[model samples]
Target chain A: MTIPNEISGSINNIRPMSQSANRLMNIVADPEYDCQDIIDVVAMDAVLTAKLLRMVNSVAFGLRVPIDTVARAVPYLGERMIVGVSLGLCASHLYNKPLTGYESEEGALWTHCLRAAIAAREIARYANDKTILDVTYTGGVMHDIGKSVISIYLEGSPRKIVQGADSGKFTDYIEGERQILGTDHCEVGAAVAAHWRLPASLTAVVRHHHEPGNSPQEHRALAYAVHLGEFVAMMGGTGTGADTLMYRIDENYKDYISISAKELELVVFNTGQEYEKIVSAMFDGQETAF
Target chain B: MKTILLGVGDLGVTNKPGEELQAQSLGAGVAVIVADSRTGCIGMDHIALPDSTVSLRRAEEKPGYFADTGIAALLEAMKVFGSNISEGGMIVKLVGGANVMDPNSTFNIGRRNVQAVKEVLWKYGLGPVAEDVGGRVNRTVTVESITGKIRISAPGREAWEL
Candidate 1:
């Protein structure tokens, strides 16, 4: 389907990811990047450096002594958390908005994103190989970026959308979106990722987190990891709204990740604990930031 | 009126008139709200998993994390508020248990949770008098202690009494 003019304009309205964040994302995407590369990039951006320090010192990371330097914070938070925090800071406007179109309250999407990020990282722990945990985390954080663009269009018609998606012969909510709005979040999220020049792997995750089977073969495993991660997020009760759990879990995830039922429980448990702390660290003192 | 909020794996009970208990954003988890018709006391539990065997240690720390322990803890909490299930004055309402679009996947924890909650209630010869459970929607459940009324709301749906 062709992009609707209005939707295109909405997509254009999304703020670009900050330069430091984009640079960090690029370095993290490459398999050969070292901790010093991340530290060098983060240190160049004073605001992000301060935020990174604040985040690591927060109770979320649970470091006993307060480490005041970027070099130390870099390895402790690792690739996943640094990228996660950078992306979060970059997209605050998109993440913090009240998705009233989805009938979700303020900060709902942000909470969902944070939980999904944690869940994705946790799910990647069981991967057959050394998965790029940071990539999976970034995928989780940016998976729903399209929702912010499409939410305004969905306002006041949630029942119609739900009934059209659920009662009709539609496969899932995304189909309902395509039929009703001429575009869906996945398409729009892909557009947003492309607009922001996100790494291709992260872009694939944005587009295929709901339907990992359809993603390109190379990026499919990361997509599946994110897919199950978002499921774990919703299962633990941290969905955006209205359309929570409305997406289908591509069962093919079993092919890519090997999490037992007991392991799944631990994923939910660990995600919940980490989610709470991240939420606290991000919002504890800065009520007005959101 | 004081309002109490229940997060995942938490339960609460109140006898004070005008007190309200609420649980929000219950995706696959289930919330069981019990009220006494005569005394107007209310109890609620927001349970995450179907069985406590998932992690006995975590469940031990947070009994309300599972249907079995959560319901048991909820009932025990109600007794302190002068409400008893055997007296027949109690009313139960169930909410949440929304599944991801897949019904066949073992990850359909929502279905399992609803079934587990029902089975636990069955053991007490009890069941929800009214329910708004199962779907692809997150729910926020609220109960008014004084009125003995339960209200269920979702993203798009209007608030309705259970």
Candidate 2:
């Protein structure tokens, strides 16, 4: 009998971020990095430097004076903000990938990730550890890596997946994926992260985000943040998908971050507004047909 | 046919024959309160979250955002399309308020939206003849004005008349 490999094959096909882009990612992720370090890394890519400068000058960033150089943008927007823009640019295709089985329209996943990333940043601010900001943002954006990888395998059985997600019985989406394919998207996503040689902690965030209760203690916080971020996106209605309500919200997440209900609603509202702004700036208000 | 897209907290009415009215991707905390003239007119509102824990007095400030105010606003808009509320010829249909959130969460806003809508409709002496409420799916509702037919569909599922 011959064995068919799906998860590993999807991982192999994924193009990792460019070397300079990866370096920029690390530089921005670390709080120790300074303006010069950010300028140094971003200056290496002419395209990225120009794009970054143009972005900071755009009305979306609320900058009155135009940013003519990477150094100015680095200081103006900060390294963390720069890294976020860089991730969206370098891995734009990853978020833009068409997952017919998972999402209802094109760019639906990207909208979700953008909002989730912003939401993750908001939730991480409330965490006890301030160092997880970059990781939490990265984890939030890449949390659904597995959905794209496993999308093709489930294309034929989307009805079953939707039915399972819409069952309204607190059904676990991962379990539904397992029933359709021998492997689930989370396991596939983690393997892809490993193949990309991403940080183990990041891999943990993608792997355990759906089931934060089972995640390792060290990685649980990021997982919890990402998990909550997903809820914020779905509830806010940006990334409309078949699995919109299929996922579960961890009740203990409030215990982890200590967010009040009023505050949560406010955050969701602010995030939705921000999502529209980001989408307008990036996609030019181009939404895929629903 | 003219079509109107209802965003959250938005309401509209159209009597133009063959015109279509739609609301897409309503979450658990959201509701789509619809009233059809049963001829060539339709009205709908995509009401956003309405917290039952909050009193009606406090929530009434922005009635369009919550179910109580949103449903009232939608019904009021129907008069422009020749809907007679007192005559009870209006056929009401509720298409959203799905419990798409995790059951374990502290709040079940979707169920609350449905509850508030039902209660408000009862007070108005208006009840839905058709309701496709409560599930995990993000419903897309379409109302055809000419025939007064509504169809709701989710991704990867067949669209059916409601």
Candidate 3:
């Protein structure tokens, strides 16, 4: 089925940023913003604050002590994690919805996204490139934002997409999306990142994660990290299914990342443990605004 | 002829003269053959975690159950067809073990599966002569008994022999 160009174009333009996310972004970009200012903003939204605290305390952070409040988490998690948390909080709502054309269920896409972000952070750390941690986290979380738009456009036709996905027609499903919705999720996600004025590295990560060869050199590492992370997520069966397993890993990336097969195994083992804790905590909290 | 097929995990693939089986993602299905001069053994394993290639969640009811499936499949193949193969002339090779699941979850069936295979092989005194296993990518593996050559297939990547 084909979508009209105008409708598809509008679908590409869709961005799911909530009002709270916009405010959080402002706080992150504001030069004079203090911890208290961020805390105050979080406090105003009890659900986001609780989610933030739960995430900070989750095993993903490798925190030794339990964090009771957002105020307490700030100093320990620092500004970068705080930003990641805020972004997580803001984007959680969007992730609650399902992705059309992908077999992921409600929360599956978000879970995969969050895992990729965390994996990206760990990979960056493993590669001794800590500076990109925040960007990687943000990029990983938002990498599939385009899927959100695709989901909306294909709202009533999820079964068709799932059938296509099961039959190894994922590329065809995306092509059908292009025909009916005007654009695919990758381009739409990239547009959302652009609208948010995210870093170029992040935009690239969102845009080309599905096909890493298309990424520019500067963003290639970031793209690879997400690609690897997402693959791990899919294999683990926490996010998508095995439908896309046929994709290749770039051998060239091995040179830059220094990740051997053994190291990759370790990453998966470690990340799986962390994902369990984070998901448990995310669901444990009384409030669920984020 | 009898053949023994070995399947390696991500780490196992890197340490070898064995062919690398590139599956689409981890947890994707893979076929490996181990044989000698006359007989062939076929085995299938699915990755249960996500890494570079594919992603899959552990079966929620029994988190690490799939690990045993890989070993059982191979052993069952050997038991069922053990008597029909050629005498002392046999070759062994390996493939499969993609990390395609949530990296940060509590399940680690992929690593466990790799270890289980190794342990089972050691018990049976059937070591791999050549192998390609592990990584995030899925692999399709085939072994030729006559030449003892193994072929692997991966998407967007070239096929190679080990």
Q: Is the docking of candidate 2 incorrect, acceptable, medium or high quality?
A: acceptable
Give the per-residue lDDT digits (tens) of candidate 2, residues A1-290.
11138557767888987776677656644646565876787888887887777666766677677779887776666665566667667776766677777655666776777788888877787776667776777787778877777787778676776666557432667667787787777788887777767776778888888888778887788888888887777766655366776776777776577676556655655565566665555543234311
Off by over 4 Å in 1: A59-64, A74-78, A288-290, B86-88, B101-104
Score candidate 1 by TM-score against the native. 0.92
Clashing pairs in 1: none
lDDT of 1 by residue, B17-136 (tens): 778999988888899888888788889999988888878997889899899889989989888878888888878889988876553356777887899999999999898887888878
How much lDDT does candidate 1 score?
Answer: 0.83
Candidate 1 lDDT, tens digit per residue, A55-162?
778776778999888888876677677778787777888988888888888888878888998999899988775555667787888899899889999887667777
**Model 3 over residues B1-162: C-alpha lDDT tens digits?**
232333223111111223332323334323334454444333333334333222234333322223434444444445464522235444555565553333442223444456555665566576667657655444555544334456665432456877
lDDT of 2 by residue, B1-162 (tens): 677887666777887876788887776645454554454567777766654234365345545566767777777777766676776667778877766454444335567677777788889887888789876667888787767778788776788888
Please list the C-alpha lDDT of all candidates, in the order they appear.
0.83, 0.70, 0.55
Which pairs of residues collide in candidate 2? none
Score chain A of each prediction against the true chain A by TM-score and list the results.
Answer: 0.93, 0.87, 0.73
How good is the docking of model 3, by CAPRI class? incorrect
Top DockQ model = 1
TM-score of each: 0.92, 0.83, 0.58
**CA error at residue A181 for candidate 2, angstroms:** 2.6
- For every prediction, compared with the true complex, DockQ reads 0.59, 0.39, 0.12
